[model samples]
Target: MTTSLVDAESVLAIEIGSIHTRALLFDVVDGQYRFIGAGRAPTTIHAPFFDISEGIHLAISHLQEITSRILLEESRLILPGKADGSGVDQVVLTYTAGQPLRVVVMGLLEDVSVESARRLAASAHTIITEAIGLNDRRPPEAQIDALLRARPDLIILSGGTDQGASRSIAKNVDLLTFALQIIPREKRPEVIYAGNHALVTPVKDVLSTYTQVHVAPNLRPEIDVENLSPAQDILADAEFHIRSRQIGGLQSYRSILAVEPLSAPFAFARMIRFLSRINNPGKGVIGVDLGAGNLIIASAFQGNSAVSVLPMGTGPGMAQALRTIPISEISRWLPIHIPESVVEDYLWHKTLHPTLLPVTTETAAVEQAAIRQVLWNGLNQHRTRYPNTPLLAEPILAAGMPLTQWSPQTSLMLLVDGLQPFGITTFVQDAHGLTAALGIISTNNAILPVQVIESNAFVNLGTVIVPLSNARYGTSILKVKVEYEAGNQISLEVRQGSVTALPIQTGQTARVHLQPLRPITIDPIGKDTTRSFKVIGGVCGVIVDARGRPLSLPTDAARRRDMLKKWAAGFGA
Candidate 1:
């Protein structure tokens, strides 16, 4: 057998999200994947093809332009007067579809299986089109009609334990059959049964008669736990196939040594999960990908054992911020006061023209607020979709276009603190929003990315210490000891109802430990006297408690403004 020689040169991977398309060249320097020059451009989805090839071309062209400029500036440093050398070795293009793969959940009970199904889909970043179950009490025809109208890409059918509850499973299978009969033959959806194993063959036979049918092990094998791997993989594969068939110009992508274009993001996400788990076990990790048309929120919890994706994006946020919310809300968050009508006009223009640059400072502030609002809303929706998971020292990982222009305060409020009902221990941002690109590259070439993530690819923004005594709301629960290296120690008791802020500037480490003051009764949503936690410094930096409990929007406008201002000031935002 003859073996082909591989070149040592770098290969460039380009990722096109719903909003922005980016290109990054990667080369192994000192056996590490170092980022060479990069380029970016707007994604193209309005065109007839929605193929992603055209967007890739625009991104590559931008990269070429920027590379040319960089080479021109650095030419004197190198001999032989070379401005451009080899250009890009190879181009790998990956994209996320603007349209989410609508998901339908069929299960036994609304609480047991339906809720778990919602969490699985949310973690996968897929959309739930319809959630139907035995308790739902909707007629077979109603469920079928909803399925056909939604034209979901895949159906996640779950019910019963391994040998428990057959009526719900049988009923759900009948509903699947009804749905397949009504949907067009060519467009019949894919079905995955993660339910009772005894019914798997029945499900396959019923759905295979008219649509694509797949089966994974029961998601709720026991009443207590959820096994999502098999189902998630099946759903991810179906999504790839569906997008590949629909989005044109994918044939060019199939020629790559490995991976189809549509499947690259999933592949990348899986790789990140693998690495994150290996490094930080049982940590809740979240990644925010902000695109033009849609924003994808990917989250992983329990040592990367779980992941979910959300499709709400800045495009919709910009539109809603400009129209749905008042100009006064926008003004309150602005750095400097401006006319409400002027802000309205600016936001109106932005809503109509989604891609305009913020030319003035006032406009820039408005854009920042719009970004914050979008993230806040998106995170709220995320929490609601998947609730009641204890967050333990989780790091919020965010990558987006807006992050490239992220201010410290905006980053803190929107990223570090936004959507964190529990509390975020650290906030890490990908400067180029190219995690997907890195993710895709890591599949075949895993070493580079493995090193990158291990070696400071993520910046730690101090730690957040939360004191918990399992106490009821309004209880004085615990005491915290914070030891600073600068020869100072502070002891504080956590009080319920009021959020205590312990200031910790960036680059200062505090060692903090907690001691429960009393055995406190726990309240689900309300604050008790024992609701207090303490702060400490660590190897990373001083700990702060920015946990704004009693999740509520500022009701009094003036009071809300003052509170926000105080929060901003306290956090050094």
Candidate 2:
């Protein structure tokens, strides 16, 4: 009998990213899965070494040296661990190195089918260059010209309910067929028919001659319910196949893996879904990864998740981010006065050399300021997708430079300043960059994720209590009394527009009694009601942010710098 994936003792996980290639070793020690060692090397997808496997090998070699184990046999990863525990039992791969999928969505309705297609595209890290709707005013020739100009890698055709209209659907299909004919056969984009099942055969018959056509279950089968998983799965598989061919030697990389590789953003969405399902019920989970090349925001609520990948990040995306946020907005987060021109220059330099670390306080401040805006932009985009979902009360997990490279206090402050959570919320950081890898691992064995999370794979940044109110800056916001360990009591006062941190060490839990003054409300459970709850502490302990809703900074440059300095001091950043 084959051993179950959960019973497999050792696993080797690799992540190939735009900037770095990381390898991690996980083994079942003392009958539980735990992370053993890790290694990272600069990605070799560019110039001299175009093959991604070169960096993978180097990273694995570093891991072998650290763990004193042989991972590669004849330049290929060893599988099914030897009797002496010399090799791993499984290998999992994930990557974020190639260009995002360029997708064109064609639908009849903007709200129903088009919206569904857009959500699927976002989850797959696709850049939607063109969306053709029935109500579009563009002429047929204009639409076809635009589609050809866009040069999409894939086209998603979704419209019409189960037994809905057929004339409009046929017209759109005819338009697509004509467009596909004009493009060269070798360069024609693949087609995914996710419209009415009744039209699948005719749709396939029309497009199969010029391009490969895939039939997915209708996205809006009945108009009231949406079954998007089938279409999303197809899109993910198509994306993986297309990307594997684009990235040299990635097909060989896939052949050596235990299972098919997953896109980093898709894997992240899976991880957040798992975390949200098992860890917190009723409340949602939010995850943000602000990398040098891309910014990814994923959220999970009630077992469903959505992901948004913005190409605006710390490196190449910095230029795009600068266009979105003004220089003065970024300057307000800096503690010291720096000229806007100098700040702009530094950002451009970073775009040229993304891997360089900030050695000076000024540079670090600039990077943090940019990070704040990146998070702000990402959050706004997320809210646009999930308008009614409340992200402020969800548990947040953040990764990348701003959180991993800074002090715990500084990282926490950046998150607080950027996210501005309301009510009671938990914050954690992916210090080791293992969330995506673990997400892929979880797909093979459900039990492994629980084991790894329980083993402290993430750094807990502690819980924050944010009261929703608008009051005078100097007035009292709330009074908190903590009772812990043999009835010891500590009383603390939080004033409006101020942040207070209480040191409560890891592995300790405290019972907190919160009394909000008049006009102030603790929105976690109820409004303007005194509440008593238990909270856990982590590296930075519990933080009480009495900052008002829609946090504002001073308009004056001098005062803003001074206020930012005070805020940084308050958090011990």
Q: Give me the candidate number with maximum lDDT.
A: 2
TM-score of every prediction relative to native: 0.74, 0.95
Clashes of 2: 0
Question: Which 10 consecutive positions of candidate 2 have the poorest summed lDDT?
Answer: 1-10
Q: Each candidate's lDDT (Cα)?
A: 0.61, 0.83
Candidate 2, residue 203: lDDT: 87
Per-prediction count of colliding residue pairs? 31, 0
Residue 108 error for model 1, in Å?
2.9
Query: By TM-score, who's the top model here?
Result: 2
